[model samples]
Target: MELKAISDDEKQRYKTVVLKFLEDLSYNLDDKAIINYINKLKKEFAPKTARMHIIRIRAFLKFIDHPIANLIELPKVPKRRRRLVIKVEHVRDLLREIDEKLSGPYRLKLKSAVLLSATSGLRAEELYKLRLEDIDLENRTIFVRAEIAKDYEDRVTFFSKEAQDVLEEYLNTFKPSNPLFSKKSLLHQFSKLDTRLRMKHMRKFFSQQSDRLGMPTAVKKILMGHSTAGDVDLSHYDFQDEEELKKIYDEYWKNFRILG
Candidate 1:
């Protein structure tokens, strides 16, 4: 592998997992050793986490062209029974909780993050990697750069005015030079919240609200930076026009707006 597209945190995770595997198992990369290590992982970690560890280990083995790579089997993980649906009320309640629990620059940072992610459907990594230049307050648009984007493609997406207001306040207060938010610090503060709500759920909220407001599926997918590789309409249709996208987002803003 090519790792240029992987985020720093992802690379670190892969490194940590591989190192742990080497430390716990034999230095010699053998099929038996790998299987034993995976079994130990299943015993020590949750099913999904164990599955992830195996995936990382398998990637490393394949990178070195080990014959055992093809023989390794991933442990089964239980599928989710239902998808978590986020609503405007949940976001409102969370923001109220944040206000009651936090203050100063930290409060504004988290507020801006939650609102932006909720409105723009940005991934946590994408939100963390955003820079001052990537945001256009006047237009209420965000530019997801190719390097930071999950799909490794550049895309412009719009945010609600409610998000824009808080974001503008945050910028004026902190005036960051680059890399608008610290991923470590942001995640640390977010963990302090008492709710089970997560940053990823904010994106889900945006998707849910967009569908509820009658946004075209292809347009919604484009806004979320999803790949059009297999989609017939998205792959062949011209839905990349920034102005047109902004107009559609504006039309649905009333229903999608999370705050006044």
Candidate 2:
């Protein structure tokens, strides 16, 4: 599993689930035992979350050359009917609320996080793992490292000038050598704010706004670190150089701008 490049968090989850399985079933390792375990998980967690647990458990069984791994099937997850759309005004209001209710370094750090997520479509975990070395302030670009990326693919993503300015201010003030944001700290502060928006919503905001502004689908996928496996443009056509991608992002910056 380690050689497979599974993320640390994923590895930990697998470990926890496997340990529980061993404690409950005591190496019974039969189809019935697995079914019982999955039933327990369904009662304890949401359908999607329980499905994830089963998937991880199946991977562990396969790793150990267990015959039942292939026979195990995943439970169906209900599809979400409503998708939340975040508008520019929503983001503006959230930022304004943060500015009014918070102060000092915490305020700047949270603001920087919001802008970066809104403009770059970076995942929350990716933002938390961001380091000073990953950022190029002059170019307004971020280098998402392979280990930190969800898909474990290294990619370059651009941020708006607004994000650059705020990030520069935060860096200049704190001069942090560690990761740019702490998952716990940022989430805690965000929860305190009186808004319907969550950190996850920022990435959706970026995706929607970019599409509205006419960003090519291929470019959007690349910037967001999404798999373009069968995409004709990304697969056959020559990929845009960093300068070209930056130019495209710059053209959409007006819509991305959250504050004056």
Q: What is candidate 1's TM-score against the reference?
A: 0.82
lDDT of 1 by residue, 74-159 (tens): 88999989877887899998998889888888899889999999988999889988988898899998999998888789999988
RMSD of candidate 2 to true structure, Å: 3.3
Worst 10 residues of 1 by lDDT: 251-260
- Per-residue CA lDDT of candidate 2, range 1-260, in tens? 77876668878988998888878999888888877887889899988998988898888899889888898888889998997888889999999999998899889999999999899999988999998899999888899999899999898988888888898999999886578788888988888899988778889998998888888777887889888787889654227787877787788763357886
Error of 1 at 198 (Å): 2.9
Q: What's the TM-score of each model vs. the native?
A: 0.82, 0.79
Query: Candidate 2: lDDT over CA atoms?
Result: 0.86
For model 1 the local lDDT of residue 176 reads 64
RMSD of 1: 3.1
